[model samples]
Target: DAMVIQNPRYQVTQFGKPVTLSCSQTLNHNVMYWYQQKSSQAPKLLFHYYDKDFNNEADTPDNFQSRRPNTSFCFLDIRSPGLGDTAMYLCATSRRTSGGASETQYFGPGTRLLVL
Candidate 1:
């Protein structure tokens, strides 16, 4: 069973329009991540927040921003969505542990954005 959930499974927006995607998790994970995946391309890590410490990928565009108001909720804001921004926005959650071993991430269904 997936603990992560993303709202607005499908969305359509106009070019240059601002849009927001929401994600929430049932499990109280310490870390959350946002990824953008274009068709036939690998998902790119936009950013991740670990217990209020936000970390953005160096290559992530400035148009993308994220907020984690609380432990269970996170929001992705696209200031000016473009045609190229049309892609699947994925939300994932994981627990950060002291061990070096990799932790498994629980992913949401993802919100598909279509910019016209």
Candidate 2:
């Protein structure tokens, strides 16, 4: 199946500690992205890689970082997870097709992090 995968649908961590979340895709897409959704807010793009080219959303916080070691995998590293870091982290992928302004992105179930 050409889909995104996220492990540990739920995660628990203490405040001020570091946490690592992951995502993988079987779609053979060239772009992979990480987004953070806090409560009912929109999924804000944290960063992404365009076939080894890393692009960070301007508004994304400094505490968030991502790495795509290869085509099939990527990792998100939270250097110091604060209380506000607790939220649903999503991994997404999309093929840069010729869709007009609405190329759909496929998402994984997400990893829910709870900071205590």
Candidate 3:
């Protein structure tokens, strides 16, 4: 029963509208990550918070942002969702307390967004 939970598996919005997707984990992991995956392509890392240390991928667009206000919860915010922005938003976590790197990341089922 202890796992990540994401509200509303599907989201539909108009282009340019702001949208938010949420994630919460019961794993008590120290690192939480957000990824954007489109059409079965590789999940692109957007950003992550490692114990309040936020790391964003270099090429990730400015339209994407994240907030991890607490240990258990994280949110992905799209300032302006575009048609090309439609994708599955995935949330992941790792304990990663031993060092700065960990290969195993537990992922949420994901939130699918459709921009019209």
Candidate 4:
């Protein structure tokens, strides 16, 4: 089945180290979403890309960056991961209709980051 795939289900990084998480979709969706979810908290939208255009949330930190080279791939880069940055990073993909409405998003299993 076509789906979103995230690399390295688990990640470990040292304090102030750089880390990157990647996602790819086989469904050929137009929009891809990146989310951060901490334990016991709802997932927060960090950023997204529609085609090649990037959209970031107002409260997203500068430490986080994203890139989408094509419709199928997206990447999240944490420039300097802190202990507080340890959380689950989720990737999702959705198709936008001609009327400008987006369909349901399909999420990958997620990559869990552990900062040490």
Candidate 5:
């Protein structure tokens, strides 16, 4: 089935180390998003790409960055990993239909990061 997929489901990094997470999809959607979710909290939107247009959430930290090299692939780069930065990174995709409504976003399994 066409779906979003993330690599290296589990990652371990040291304090101040840089880490990169990746996502890819077969769904050919126009919008792709990255979210950071901490324990017992809501998933926070980090950034997204709407057909090459990049949009970053206002409150997302400077250390968090994203790149969508093409329609099917996106990457999340943490410039400097910290202890507090350990969380589940989720990637999703969706598109607005001709009916002028947004479709439901399909999410990947997610990548869990551990900082030591």
Candidate 6:
């Protein structure tokens, strides 16, 4: 089935080390998104790519960055991992309606990160 896929379902990284998490989809959706979710909190939208155009949330931290080189794949890069940065990273895909208001996002299982 066509769906979003996130690699290395679990990750462990040292403080100050850089880590990259990846997402890919086979649904041919027009948008791909990355979200950061901590325990007991809602997932926060970090940014998204609508085709080649990138849209980032205003409150998204400078430490969180994303790259979508093509339609099917996207990556999240953390320059320096911190204990507070540990969270489940979610990847989602969506397609806009012609009216641009009724779209739904499909999310991957998510990749959990643990800071050491």
* Total backbone collisions for each predicted model: 0, 0, 0, 0, 0, 0
Q: TM-score winner among the candidates?
A: 4
**What's the lDDT for candidate 1?**
0.94
Tell me the tens digit of each residue's lDDT in model 3 across 69-115. Answer: 99999999999988999899999998875766775799999999999
By lDDT, the better pick of 3 and 5 is 5
Evaluation by TM-score, superior candidate among 4 and 5: 4
**Sort by lDDT, top down from the best:** 4, 1, 6, 5, 3, 2
lDDT of 1 by residue, 12-105 (tens): 9999989999999998888999999999999899999988999999999999999999999999999999999999999999988877333788
Model 6 lDDT per residue over 1-112, tens place: 9999999799999998999999999999989999999998999999999888999999988888899999999999999989999999999999977777537899999999
Report lDDT per candidate: 0.94, 0.89, 0.92, 0.96, 0.93, 0.93
Against the true structure, whose lDDT is highest? Answer: 4
Report RMSD (Å) for each prediction in the order shown: 1.4, 2.1, 1.0, 0.6, 1.2, 1.1
Off by over 4 Å in 2: 97-102
- Kindly list the per-residue Cα lDDT of model 2 for residues 45-105, writing each as its tens digit: 8998877989998988898888899999999999899998999999998766555232568
Clashes by residue pair, model 2 = none
Q: Which pairs clash (backbone N, Cα, C closer than 3 Å) in model 1?
A: none
For model 1 the local lDDT of residue 71 reads 96
The positional error of residue 40 in candidate 2, measured at the CA in angstroms, is 1.9
- What residue runs in model 5 are displaced by over 4 Å at the alpha carbon? 98-100
Better model by TM-score: candidate 3 vs candidate 4: 4
Any idea how many clashes model 2 has? 0
Please give each candidate's TM-score: 0.94, 0.91, 0.95, 0.98, 0.94, 0.95
